[model samples]
Structure formats: C-alpha cells, structure tokens
Target: MRIGLLTDGGYPYATGESRLWCDRLVRGLPQHEFDLFALSRSADQEQRGWVRLPDRIGRVRTAPLWAPHEEDTRHPGRTRRPQGRIATGLGRAYGRRDRRRFTAHVTALVESVCAGPEAGPGPGEPDRAADLFTAGLYGLAELAQERGGLHTALRSEATVRIVESACRAPGTGRTVHSATVPDYLAFAAGLERALRPLSLDWYDDDALGAVDLCHAASGGAAALPGLLAKRFFGVPLLVTEHGVPLRAHYLAVPETPLSAPVRALLANFHGLLASEVYRQAALVTPGNTHVRRWQERFGADRDKLRTVYPGMEAERFAAVGEGEDGGGPGTLVWIGRIEPAKDLIALLHAFAEVRRDEPGARLRIFGAPVQGGEGETYLARCRALVAQLFPEEGTDAQAAGDHPVTFEEIGGAEVPDLAQAYAAGGVVVLSSVVEGFPISLVEAMFCGRATVSTDVGAVVEVVGGTGLVVPPRNPRALADACLALLRDPERRARLGAAARARALELFTVEQNLAAFRGIYLDLVGQAPARWTAPPDARHPAGRPRPFATPPEAHVLGDLIREPAVPGAARVPSWAVGAEGVCAGARGAGDGDA
Candidate 1:
C-alpha cells in the first residue's frame, strides 16, 4: 500500500522534531511504498540537507513553510530544489458572485473561531466553518489552477478588508476587537502562507490522491496538507500528534511581538482548524494521555483517539539495564535538552535540599543546550545559578570545589553516548515543570535507574507506578522523592527493575511500529466516501477534481471503499492484502532498504 507520510520540520531533515520516529516507522514497514510530503520551517533546515531515505520511499516532495511562494511549476512527486524567497505575486480574478461566496465562507470561518464551546449560534445548528473553510480554500485553488497561481491576490487589500470585517462582526471576541489594521494585514499575510498547500500541484490523481492513507507526523502545519489531500480525494487521514498543536500555539507565542488580540485571533483560527481536522480524520492518535485529553477537549471523538507511545531503541541501553548495580550510591543524574521548561532552577534548589541531609551527594547534568534553539541563555543562567546556590547556604564555596555539581555534554570521551551517561548515575532526576513524555526518563528506565520526576505532561503515565512522581515546581517534594530513593538502595533497585520491565513492554520501537501497522490496516478496511460538489461552479470547464463525501454523513464505515464496497476492480492491487504482509512478524529474512 502507498502511504503519504506528512511532516513539518522533521524526517529526511538532519535536525527536526519528529525525525527519528518517522524514520523508524518507514524503515520498520519496508513492504509499503512511501511518499514523503514535508514542509520546511527554516532555510537552515533545507540547507542542512536531508537524511538518507530508504528505497521504499518512492517519492519525497517538500516546500518551504517560510517562503513567499514557489515560482517553480514542478509537480510535488519530484523534489523542488531550495531557492530564494520571492515576494507575493498575483491572484485569479473573482466576479461579483465569487466575491459573495468567498465573503460568506471567510466570515463563517472567522466567526466560528471567535465563538464558544457550542461553537455556532444555536445547538446542533452547526458552525459549518469546516465546510466553508474547505470550500473557500479549494475554490481559490481551482481559481489558481485556472488562472495561473494566487500569490498577488492572497496579499491584496481586498483580502485584508474581508478579514477585518469578520473581526468587527457581532459576537466577535474582545481580542478580535482589539486587533489593529496592521495586525489584520499581518495575519492575512500569514494565512496566505498557511494556505499555500491549496495552490500546490499535489492534489492531482497522480500525487496525494493516489496514496491509500495520509499519515501526518505532527498536527497543525504538517497535517494541513493531509487535510487538503482528504478534501480533494477520498483518502483517509491519520493524525498522530505527540504534542497537542493547539497547546503548543498557546505556549510558543508570547504577547510582546504579537498583541494579545492577534495572538487570540490566531489561536482561535488554529483551534477551529484543529477541530475540523479532528472531525474529518478517520483516526487520531495522540502519543500519550496528556495529548489525548487535549484532543478530546478540542472536539476529537474519544473512540477515534489512540494513545501511541513514542518509541525508542531499547537495545542500545540493554547492556547497562541488565547489569546488577547501577552506578554510584550518592549520585543524581539529569539528562536532556537544556531548556527553561526543564526547570533546572527547581532541580538545583531540590539538590541543595538533598545536600542539607546528604552532603556527599553529587549531581551530574549530562546533556547539551539545544543548538540554535531557545536554550543558550537558559543554559548560562543555569550554570550561574548552580554556582550561587551552594554558596548562599553558608556552605564553603571553596570546600564545595567546583560546586558539587557538574554540567557536561554527551559524546565526550568519558561518556561516549547517552547509555554510558545513564550508567554513570544511580538515580535519574526529572525536574521539568513542563514536559512531553520525558524521553530521558524512559532512557533512564531502559538503563535500570530509579527516577524521581515532577508530575507534568505524561510523567506519571510513563512512570506507571514504577517511579516516584512529585508535583511540578515543588522543590521540597522533588527533594524528598530523590531523598527517599537515595536513602534506600534496595527500594531504588526494586523500582529500577520495575521501570525497566515497563519500558521494555511499552516503549520499544518494535511495539510502536506494530501499533501503527495495525491502525493503517484498520483504516484501509472502510468504504470510500461519496462525492460532493459546491453550490456554484460558474465556469465548469476549468474546475478541478470534484470533492467527495458520504451522501448521508461521514461515519467510520466510509474509510475503505475498494473491493469490499462493490467496485472491486477499481481498488488498487496493493491495497488488497496489506494486513497479512505489513502486519506480519518481523524477521532477518529481508535486508535493510
């Protein structure tokens, strides 16, 4: 079966958020033909070059998330070489009727975003923004295809005026009311970029339309193309969000550069978009309960959501995890990307508290600052705070030589890799006030070390009663948990063993691949949806492929639409028996792709 693996700033790129797991999934299922659809977030990501893809990856198509617009007419199945960003160019002409249709669609989209839980005006009345948004988005796409592309028109004064009208409409939020003219223009510009996928040549029968399933690596920008694919074609979409996109939007942008009004407006837009994505998706998989709860709260059906844990290669740490003893008795280790969210300050204070009772105890920080990320400043602050911490408690700075704390990076001579670093300490500590699955904690578990982590973002879920979890930002509780494990070597040993057992069972790469493989087969077993046409297609000659949906309503049954649904011959042969092949047990029978 053909799979369109969608990604944003990940996979194929040397440095990306979801690169590892994506590669693992593709490599694990070698029998399936894969098509890579990636969106590059930065020029550096494009310049750094792509990771070597296996032969099974039949095609890789990518575009810049930050570029003005592509001038090249290259089809998406082939690679588009990196080029300079050109300013926004032109748009197709819209007649009087076209203008009215566009206005209603944009207005509904904006108003739905600004509305409350029962999103539209009345109960069961329906916001219909999803329909309007898709219609408007594709309508423009059809126009772009007929009359060259929509670069200049998307940035026109008319587009800004429509957005502003929506913001000033009745029932609009206070935040929308506060947005100035400049804010509206800025947002309109950003919206054009976000909608770039609509103008792409990817939606044809030979590209995204040909794929059996569209599997998005992350939500939001990455999933946008998948959403379009499902819209243009009857393909089923599977969204796997490791970190909830809506929450990330709330956390990523501050109110300084963007006003509260603009931030709120953008958040609402993304929220509405997320709701639509969830509603249309055949299956939504969240990496953990933390993300799953976010999805459910944002209109995802509970049944449609599955918790697929992010998998790691456990065998790398197998040697250390299986051993009898786990490092020094009085050592505490913290390892991961150095960032403010990790809450190193609270950990340092907690370590000070631990030192009050056990002076000989040492803390070893094994990790480096996230390169080119928001960590260099935080890293320096942490190092300074570490030096000042022990001295303020009347402890001799001289006696505490080099501060009783050591901050080091991995891949050094002493610690060649992550496994060796985990092996150098008995107790692994996670003091993060904000986290997502805590990958380092899992690595610690794989290395058979007791963990004391703050209760935040799936920590407790991952621990599963195997490790001590304390409330986030509580230094006393964090210190005490570490103290309890440190004082009792037997308890630490027992917990470490249990943690390793849990990790081995639930968090291995093999298990993750198996779960997704199962989900892919299940999605392929449903009926194809019936097609739907817009209210007006004045110029039918230039119209793109007719969009389709089930005549009644889109239910779970509409997912598979091949041999099982009357049109047996129309079904591609590859989609017929994916269950027995990809779902089968792995062996050394085949070599690496």
Candidate 2:
C-alpha cells in the first residue's frame, strides 16, 4: 500500500521542525511506498534545498504556501477572469450552477462559524459544526474542480458579501455580528488562503486519489489536502501532530494587521477545520499528553488518539554513557537551542547560587539557538545576563572560557557534540520556562546522566520521576536540586543509571519504529482496497487475472497453499520477543476509549 505523506512547514525542507522525524520515519519503513507532498513555509526553506531522499519514496510533490499562486494551465484559452465581467455570462464566468453552489457552501461555512457549534439546524445538516464545515468545504471544492480555480472566485466581491451576510445572520455571535465591510473583506481574504488547497490539481486518480492512506505530519493547512483526498477518494487519513497547530495559531502574533473580531472569526474557522479533520481521520497521534488533551478538547475521539513519543537516536551517546568518567564532579550542563523560552537568564542566576555554594562548580551551556535572526538577540542578552550574575574569575576575567558560566555550541574544544557536553557535567539542568517535549532532558537521560529539569511541557511526563524536578524560573530551587546532585556522587550515579535504564526501556528509535510500523500495517489493512477502473477492461497488469474476473476477485495463484507440517514455518516477527511492537487494532500507548 502506498501512503500520501503530507507535511506543512517541514519535511523535505532542510530547515524546519520535525524534518528529522519525518526523514527517520520514511527511511525506517521500507515495506510501504511513500508519496511526499510538502508545503514549504518560506522562500528560504525552499532555497535551502531538500534532504537526500531514500528509494522507498515513490514520488515527491511540493508547493509554497508563501509564494503567489501559479497560473492554472488546465484549461486552454482560459486567462484570469477579466475585471468588471461579473455580468458577462454566468456561464462563461463561474457558471451560474457553480456560483450558486459556491454561495451556498460559503454561506453555510461562515454562518456555522459565526453562530458557533451551538447554532441550531445549520445548512440542512446536523447541528454539529464539523458536519456543517465539511459539507461546505467539499461543496466549494467540487465547484473549484468545475471552474478553473477559486483564486478569483474566493477573493471576489461575491465572497465578501457572503461573509458580511453570515456575520449579520440570525443567532450570530455579537463579535461577528459587529463586523464592518472592511472586516468582512479581511476575513474573506483569510478564508481564501486557508482554502487554497481546493484550487490545487493534485486530487485526480493519478495523485492523492490512488493512495491507500493519507498520513498528515500535522494539522492546519498541511492536513487540508489529506482531508480532500479522504472526501473525494475515500482514503483513510492518519494525522500526527507533534504540536497542535490550532494552539500555535491561537498563540502566534498575527503577521498582518487585523481587528479583534477578525482574529476571533479566523480562530473559530480554524477550530472548525481542525474538528472536521479529526472527525474524518481514522487515527490521531499526538506527541504528548499536552497535545492530546488539546485534540480531545477540540472534539478528537479519545479512542483514535495514540501517544507516540518522538524518537531519538541513542547511539550518539552510547560511548559516553558507558565511558570511564561519570562526568565532572562539580559541573551542571544545559543543552538545547538558545531562545527566550529557554529562560537562560534564570539558569545563569541559578548557576551563580550554585557557584557560591559549591565554590568550584561550573555550568557549561551547549548548543546553538533555533535557526533565524531571533537567536542572535537572545544569545546576546543571555551573555550580558551571565556577565551581570557572575563577575570576577580565574586570571583573565575578560576571557569567556575562564568564567564559571561558559557558553559554547555543540562543537568546542572540551565539549564536542552532544555526547561530550553530557560527559562534561555530572548533572544536567534544564531551565526552560516553556518547552514542547524537553528533548534535551531525554538526551541527558540517554547519556546516563542525572537531570534537574523545570516542570514544563512534557518534562514531568517524560521524566516519569526518574530525575529531580524543579519549578520554572525559580533560581533557589534549581540551585538546591543541582547542589544535591553535585554534592552526592553516589546519588548521582544511582539516578544516572536508573535514568539511562528508563530511556533505553521507553524512548529508543527501535521502539518508536516498531510502534509506527505496526500502525502502518494496521491502517493499510483497514483501508478499503480499490479495484480496476472498468469491469470490461483489464488494468494492464503484467499477468492480468482473467479477462472475465474483476481485479478484486483473485484465485490463489502462486501463494503457498499448504500449511506448515510441524515446525516448518519460522516465528512471526512480532511474536519473536518484540514485546514493544504495536499489534492488532490497538497500537502501543493507544489511549483506551
């Protein structure tokens, strides 16, 4: 079975979140063929080039959400609709048929969003907002297929009018009802962007229509194509969200100026889209419980949710984990990208307290910030804060290496790469006030080092009480925890050993791959298989079944029919001590309904 793997702002691109995970997943599963459809977030991401793809990837298609829409070449002599030609010929223009359909669909969508899920009897469908949204979305998609594209149709004065009518519709929310003509225009523009996937030419039988399953890397615009594939081709969709895109939308500062009412309407629209995606998805995999809770609150079925922890390679730290030295006796190390959310300022203050108490203790900061210009500003501020917190040092106070707080990247003289960074510290400390998965904490665990991390995001869940936990932004508590580990070599050794054991047990690439492999097989098995196009003709197979028989009807041709005589067949792979492998309908860590 082939998979239509969909991703937004990541995968294939050299720079972005989850590229490594997507690369690993595709490479790990060789039995299934993958068709990658990636949406680049920026021109920079596109220019950076793609990661080298493997043989298992059957095809690759990409588009830029950041770029202007390319001209549609599907129809001959069909140029961009001329301006002021609205009354030319409802036939030559968006057919009177498709236009009416478009108006009905757009009306239903905006009304549902404005009136909210509590709105009664929406567009002759169920009271559920998801149903109403899906109905409207697919209706518009069908119209786009008949017409050239929705580039002009969605952004036209007609759409603006529909939005205004919906905003002022009966039972609408006060905020939506109070929208102005300009507000309607702003909202319509956003809808066009969000609904851009409908105008793409990738929904035919040669494209997503042929896939067995649509596996979305994340939700939001990334999953839009997958939703359409499921709607038009009956493909089962499996959506995996490392970070809930809906939450990201709500948290992100708007790039363009917009009114509060416009923001609220846009948020509601996205929420409705997310709910619809979840409603149609066969499974929803959340990276952590935090994201899973968000999905559940957004109406994702609890039974469909699977908690798949992001996998990391442990081989890089294996040698250091088993090395002779158990790291420095009086050092605490912090690793990961440097950003404001990391709260390096708090770590510097905490390290100052540890320096006063331990006297000889040192804090080595390792790893660069996330790619972009924000890192330089944040890094400079952190450096200044470090200087303010810790003054005089050995011999040369001007030299950064001589200071108690040494900031360095992954590659340095004493600490080269993540393994050496972990090896340079007896205890690993994470001071982030905001984090997604606390991957740095997991990396420390893999290196067989005791960790002291702030209680943020997935730290507590991933730590599972194997390491010391402290409150975020609390310098004294962080200092106390680091001091306890720094002073007691025996306790540090014990916790480090246990931490490494737990990491090996639950968070290895092998376990992660096994779980997903099972999920792929299960999803493929559940997806309905497609037969040949027409009953009268063959699908042009190398060895066609019979001229009379349909593709679905097949005899036992070369498949071995005889059962094993005694101990003839080898044990199935899943039955051979693969205790962590996901099996049957219930995968590993699938939440009970």
Candidate 3:
C-alpha cells in the first residue's frame, strides 16, 4: 500500500518535532510505500536539511511556510469586466452578504474549484468578482493540484479580498470579526498558505489518490493535506493528533505581536479547520484522552475517535533497568525540554519543601532549552532557581557547579545516553505545568523507575496506576508525593516494576504496528472499494501483498458516486499515479530523489 504521510515543520527534517517517530514508523512498516509531504517552518530548518530516508519511502515534496513566493500572474486593478448577471450580482454584494448568502457563495466557490476549470464558473461572467474569487481559489487549488504546494502566490491580494468579504458577510459566526484592511490582507495571505492544500497537486493520478490510505502524523496544518486528499479523491483518511495543534497554537501565539482581532480571526480559522478535519476523517486517533476531549469539544464524532499512544523504543533502557539503581534513595529527577511551560519555578519551590522534610533529598534536572529566544531566559531562570533551592550549587552569577540539584544535557560524557540519565536517579519526576504525551515519564517507566509528576496533559493517563501524580502548581502536594516515594523503597520498586511492564506492553513499536495494521483492515473492510487491481498482476513473484486492504473491507460498504460534499472535499481523482501507486512514495522508496 502506498501511504501519503503529511507533516508540517517535522519529519525528514533532522531538527524538528515528529522526525523521530515518523522515521521509526517508516522504518517499521517496510512493506508499505511512503511519500513525504512536508512544510518547513524556517529557513534554518531547511538549511538543516532532512534525515536520511529508508528504501520504502518513495518521494518527498516540501514547501516553506516561513517564506513567500511571488506569483507570476497579477491583476492590474481591482475591477474586471463581468459577462453575466451572476458575476455582476456577486460583485455588487461581494463586499457583504447575509449568512445564508455567504454559505451559498462559499459553497459555490468551493464547488467551482472542485470541478476542473473547463467546467468551472466561466471567465468574465457577471459574478466576475465572484468568478475571480472562484478562479483564484481554483487557480491556487489547481496550482497545488498540478504542482505540489503553493508558497509565493497564496499571499496575493485576490485571496485576501475573498476572505475579507466572507468574514464581513452576514452569516459568519460572531467569533469571526470584520478584519481591518491590513489584518484582512495579512490573514488572507496566511489563510492562503494554510489552505494551500486546497490547491496541491497531490490529487493527481500519481499521488495521494493512489494510496490505500492517507495517514496524518499529526493534526493542524499537518492534517490539511489529508483533508484535501479525502475531499478531492475518495481516499480514506486516518488522522492522528498526539498533541492538540489548536491548543499548541493558543499557548504559543499568546505572546506574539498579532492584534487581538487577527488572533481571534486566526483562532476561529484553526477551530473551523479542526472541526472540518474531524468531521471528514474516517478515523480520528488522539494520543490521549486529554486530546480526545479537545476533539470532542470541537465536534469530532465520538464513534470515529480512537486513542493511540505513541510507541517509544524500550530496548535502550533494558540494561539500565537491570543494572544497579543509580538514583540515591531520596533523589528526584526531572527530564524534558527546559521550557518555561514545564514550570521549573514550581518544581524548585517544591524541592525546597521536599528538602525541609528530607534534608538529604536532591533534585537533578536534565535536558536542554528549546531553540527559541524565550528558552534562553527560561533556562537562566531555572538555573537561578536551582541556586536558590540548592545554595551549594553556586550563586546566580556562578557558572554551573556541583550541588544538590544539577542541570545537565544528554550526550555529555557523563550521561552518554538517555537511559543512563534515568538510571542516575532513584525516582523519576515530571514537573511540567504544560505537557503533551509525557515522553520523559514513559522513558522513566521503561527504565523501571517510579515517577512523581504534576497532573498535566497526559501525565496521569500515562502514569496509570503506577506513578504518584500531584496537582500542578501545588508545591505542597508535589513535595508530599516525592517524600512518600522517597521514604518507601519497596513501594518504589513495586511501582517501577508495574510501570516497566506497562511501558513494554502498551507503548512499544510492536503494539503501534499491530494497532495500525488492524485499523487498516477495518477501514478497508467498511468502505466500498475505490479502485483495485489484481495482486498477481502487480508483483513479480505474485507474493500476496500483506498490507493492502481487500476490496471487501471498505467501511462505507461500497463506493457511492455522490456529488461533492462541501468542506469535506478530498484529494483529486487523478492524484493516483499510474500502476495504482502514489508517484512520490513509489519513487522516493527507490532512494531520495
């Protein structure tokens, strides 16, 4: 089976999120062909280049979200000649409309894009403004549809006017405020880039359309391409959102200089996109219930949602779990990116309280700062707080020195590997005030170490019945939990064993592969067949393909030729390349091209 793996600012990139897991997944399922559709978030990220690709990966198509591309075509002035009453009517009201009118127009505009331009709203028609909107929409859509993605021209003025008109129109939800001219222009450009999937060439006969399934590695912009793939083609979509992208955006952009109105507009835009992505997906997989709840709140169908924990490699920790416990009886260890969101301040205060109860207790913090301006400040703050908690560690002005609490990075000669870092402590800890999947805790579990973590994100869920969890921001409670674990070595050992068992059972690569394999068969069994060729005809040895879902497995019972569903449009019908393979994945697998 050919799989279209869509990602944004991740995967294939050596220094980005999701690169590891994506690489693991690609390597794990060697039988399936994979294509990478990636969006680079920065110039530096592009310069960093990609991780090496495996043989099964067919091709990679990338575009930049950080840079803008110049469109070759431009409109001389705002107005264009209209040929018909429809174009004229649309033009007059293009500035504003009632909710009903807005929906009708937006629906029509989207439909026009769906139908190949030859059958689209004609040139120079009365609704020329509307026609222009539709044309540009489809034109950009056509560009993405024909090429891979849009970058330069998506920021054009034509796109902005359309979004502006829609927002001001009568029926948009109250949340969508009328964007100012500048805000409108900025948002329109951003929206075009965000919605570039609408114009991607992935729907061609040789692309996503040929894939047996489209698996989105993460949600938000990463899933946009999958949404389009399902829309233009009947390709089934499997969306996996480990971390809620909407929430990430909310937390991340609050400090940006964007105006309130623009922020509100962007929020609504992502919300709507999430809703639509959830609504159209054949299956929605959230990494944990915390994220699942967010999906539910956003209108994802409960029946369609599933929880799939990310698989973490456990073999690396095997030796540590079997070796002598490196953690002192009362030691505490915190591992993760040194970001402010982790609430190192709270952890320091908690450790101070812990020290009061057990004078010998020590806290060791591991990990490096994230690559951002704020990270430096956060790191400095953490270092300062460490000095205050453990005075012997040195003063604020002192360079890092030996102390009760230590801040160290992995790959240091002393801590050569991650497992050794976990083994360095008797008790693992997670003090994050904000978190996603709690990967460090899982790693701790794999090392057979008991943990004390704040109740944030999926910490409690991942800890299950094994580790001690305390409410976030409560130093008293955290101190008490740490003290309890410290005083009871027997309890710690038992919990550590259970945690190791749990990690090995539910969070291993084998479990992830098995779950996805079953889901594939289930999805194919339910939907009517889209297109199929005899297995014998495709492979030389006629070795039965193990991954291809048989025609009878389509979940929708059978393919139904229904009119295009608005907002739920998928990949173009022609996206599947000849030989029933996605061109990118098939070609890329031979070796990176």
Candidate 4:
C-alpha cells in the first residue's frame, strides 16, 4: 500500500521539529512505500536543504508557507458585475442568503488587511481588514460546516457580496477602515494562498487517490493536503501530531503586531481548522499525553486517540553499566540541547550543592544549542555560572578532570556519540525547567544509567520509576536526589539495570516498528474502501500483486497455496497477511469495511 506522508515545517527539511522521528519511522517500515508532501516554514529552512532520503521513499513534493509568491493570478477573463467583479461572482456562488453575508464579510476582511500597519493601517486604527477577513473566513467555514463542504462553483459573485457585507458591518474593529482598495486585493490574494488546498490539483486519481491511506506526519497545514485527499479522493487520513500546531501558533501569535481582534480571529481560525482535522481523521496519534490532551480539548474523539511515543535507536548504549569498562560510580551527565528551557541556571545551582556534599562529584554537560542566534547567549551564561561555581579548575578543580564542570559538544573530546555521553556518568541528570519527553533521559536508560530528572512534560511518564524525580527549579531537592544516587552504588546499579530493561522492552526501534506495523494494518483494516479508480491509477513506480486471486477462484495457480503445509506454515492461518500481499476475501471484511 502506498502511504501519503504529509508534514509541515518538518521531515525532508534539514531544520525541523520532528524530522528525525519521521525519518526513523519511514526507514524502519520499509515494506510500505511512502510519498512525502512537505511544507517548509521558511526560505532559510528550504535553503538549508533536506536529509538524504532512502530508496524506499517514492516521491517528494514541497511548498513554502513562510513566503508565498507575490504575483496574483486571477481566474482567467470574466466580465465585471456590480459591487466590483469579485463580490458579484461570490454572491451567485453562495446563493441569495449566503451571497450577501460572504460579500460583506470578505470586503471588510480585505479592507482590514489593506489597512494593516505594514500597509498603512497605523497602530491607532486596528486592522479592521483582518476582522473582516475573519468574518468572511468563518462565515465560509460555517457554510462548509452546514453543507459538509463548499460547492465547486464557490468563487461566484455571491461569495464576494458575503465578504463585502462582513467588512462594513457595525461594532467591528477599526482596522477595517485602514483597508484601501489595493489592501483588499492583496488580502484576497493572501487568503487564496492559505486556502489553496481547497482547489488543489493533486486530489485526482494520479495523486492521493491511489494511496491505501494518507498518513499526515504532523497536523495543521501539513495535514491540509490529507484533508483535501480525503475530500477529493475519499482516502482515509491518519493524523499524527507530536506537537500540536495550534499550541505553537498560540505561543507565536502573541509576539506578532496584529491587533487583539486580529489575534483572536486568527486563533479561532486555527481552532476551527484543528477541530475539522480531528473530525476528518480516521485516527489521531499524539506522541505523548500532553499532546493527546490538547487534541481532546480541540474535540478529537477519545476512541480515535492513540499515544505512540517516538522510538529511538537504543543499541548504541548496550555497553553501559552492564559492561566491565562502564562509567565510574559517581558522575552525573546532563546531555541535550543547551537551551534556557533546559534550565542550565537551575542545573548549575543544584550542582553547586551536589559538589559541596559529594566533594568528588563531576557533571558533564554535553550538547550544542539547537536555536540559532539566542543559543550562544544561553551558552555564555551557563559557562559563566560554571566558572563562578568552581572558580579555580584543579583538584581544587572539583574532581580529577581539568575542569570540575565540563561543557563539551558531542563528537568532540570525551563525548563521541550520544551513548558515550550517558556512559561517562553513573547517574544522568536533567534539570530542565520545561521539556517534551526528555529524549536524553531515555538514552541514559538505554545506557543502563540511573537518572535524576525534574518533573515536567513527559519526564514522569517516560522515567516510570526508573529514575529519581525532583521538582523543577528547586535547587536543594535536585542536589539531594543526585546525592542519594551518588552515595548508593547498589541502588544506582539496580535502577540502571531496571531502566535498561524497561527501555529495551518499550522504547526500542523494534518495539516502535512493531506498534506502528499493527497500527497501520488496524487503521487501514477499519478504513472504508476509498480506492475506486482503475488500475491506471497506479504510479509509474508501482508494484505488482503476486497473489491477487482468491482461493475459490483459482485451481492450479492457488492449489499449492491452500491451507497449511507443515512447521511454520501450520503454526497459524491468520498470520498469512503479515507480508501485506493480496489475500483472499475469506476475511476481507477487515479491509473492505
């Protein structure tokens, strides 16, 4: 089965949030062919280039949401009617009642955009154009909600009138006043770009129509394509959101210059979009419970929700604690991106107390900053803290090393791979003030090292009794936990052993692959049969079905393929479909339903 994998600002892009996890999933599941449809956030990200994809990936298509093309392309030559051409056309499309509403709404929205501070909408006059846009947009959204979807002839005069009415409505924000004729035109252009999926060219049989399932690597605009796939081709969409895009938008919009009304409108738009995505998705897989809760709040069904932790390769840490030359018994290593969120200030303060108590303790801070410009500032501050804490740097330095607190990059001296960072210490420490499932802690467990982690995000869930837990920002508590682990060699060994066992059992690539393998079959099995196109729907790089004939339809061809022969073949009749080949319809209800 061909899988349409959609992602926004991730996967394929070199700089992205979940690129690594997406890459791992695709590589681990080689039996399935994947087509990547990615949306890059910025031109800088696109210029940085993508990770080299494996041969199993069939095709790649990308678009940039950060910077859309400036040139406006109208829908060919059409006669201009009253209320300026666009409004009349929209009016006719939306019918009499909706026609007036959509025109008024869109006009106000366009005016607000034209009036934007960047365009000349000044700070005093909130961009009413934005509000107008919101009114028109949501009006259309409400229409879609009422009618199941927008009609194909939606760009008529009625639509424009509905938009125009919304812009000129009373009690509306003042930003609408700043919207000039050109601003409205420009706003309309931007809206079209954002709503491009509504009129995408890929929904036909040649594209998503042939796929067995559409798996959105992440939601929001990345999933928009999948939404279109389901809408146009009847394909089932499986949306996987590791980090909720709506939450990110909430975090980001406050920093923008848009008026409160504009912000609220945009937020509502995103909220509505999220709800729609959840509604259309066959299943929603959130990487952790935090994300799962976010989905539920946005109205996703609990039954449709599944939490699948992103898997990591754990074999690299196989030699730790369980081996003869493992780490010394009293070191604590903090490994991960050196961002302020990692709370290095808190870690430094906690380490000071840990040092005073142990007298011979060492903390190895490994990892470079992931954020580009601001990272250097955080790194400098952390280094200064370390210098102040252990001012000298000899046996007066703290431990036996050149520096009691060493900050080194992975692939540098002392630390080579991530596994080596964990192995350098008997106890791994995480003093993050904020985090998302500390991947470093999981690596430490894989290395058979005990850990002391602050309670935040999925730290408690992931650690699962395998490590000591402490409150974030409490320096004394962190120190006490570290001291307890450092003082007990037996307890450390036991916890480390258990952590490794747990990691082996739950977090390995093998287990992740197994879970997804089952999920893929289960989801597709329950999905409605959507692929109704003829065999010509196949892509140029298609695979042939070797055993498409049913057992009842064939005599010589399937005679040898009947029941069970012996040994492994006789072990189970239900396991025959494990290879994803064409199976008989004796139990085809699973996929057909």
Against the hidden reference, what TM-scores do the models get? Answer: 0.84, 0.84, 0.77, 0.73
Q: Model 1 misses residue 416 by how many Å?
A: 1.2
| Tens digits of per-residue lDDT for model 3, 1-593 | 56788888888888878788888888987766688878777656777878989988886777655533332123433332211111012222233323234344444443322221233235554432334334444444543444334443335455566656765666454445445788777665656556655644456546766566788887878887777677665677888888999899888677978766567666655765676678778999898899999999876999999998888888888898735468677788888888888988888898899988898887888888988788888999877777666675455424453466778887987788889899988898888888989999999999999999999999888999999999998988988999999999899999999999989988988788777767865774465434433324423332222223343221211122223676564432233334343333422112111
Q: Look at candidate 1 and tell me the lDDT of residue 537.
A: 51
For model 4, the superposed segments whose C-alpha errors exceed 4 Å read 70-196, 257-259, 324-327, 394-401, 531-593
- Better lDDT candidate (2, 3): 2
The global Cα lDDT (0 to 1) of model 4 is 0.67
Q: Look at candidate 4 and tell me the lDDT of residue 207.
A: 64
lDDT of 2 by residue, 339-458 (tens): 888998888888888888888988888878766788988998988777677655642653647677777777766666778888887888999887777788888899888899999888
Residues 1-593, candidate 4: write the lDDT tens digits: 56888888899888877888888888888767787777776656777888999876886766655433332123234321211011112322446766555555555544443333333246587544344544555555444444333333244444344334544566444655444444334334435545544433345565666566789987778887787677665678999886778888887778776555445445555665677689789999888887888899876999999888888887677755454224467677888887888898998899899888887887888888866777889998988788777776744443445576877777966667777777787888999887766788888888888889999877888889989999999999999999998998889889988998887877777777787777777766566533242334322333222123231121121112333444434222333454433333323111211
Lowest summed-lDDT stretch of 10 residues in model 4?
Answer: 79-88
Whole-model lDDT for model 2 versus the true structure?
Answer: 0.76
Comparing 3 and 4 by lDDT, which wins? Answer: 3
Off by over 4 Å in 1: 69-101, 114-123, 128-135, 141-148, 324-327, 372-374, 392-403, 529-593
How much is 572 displaced in model 4, in angstroms?
Answer: 25
Q: CA lDDT of each candidate?
A: 0.74, 0.76, 0.69, 0.67
Best-matching candidate per lDDT: 2
For model 3 the TM-score comes to 0.77
Model 1 C-alpha lDDT versus the unseen true structure: 0.74
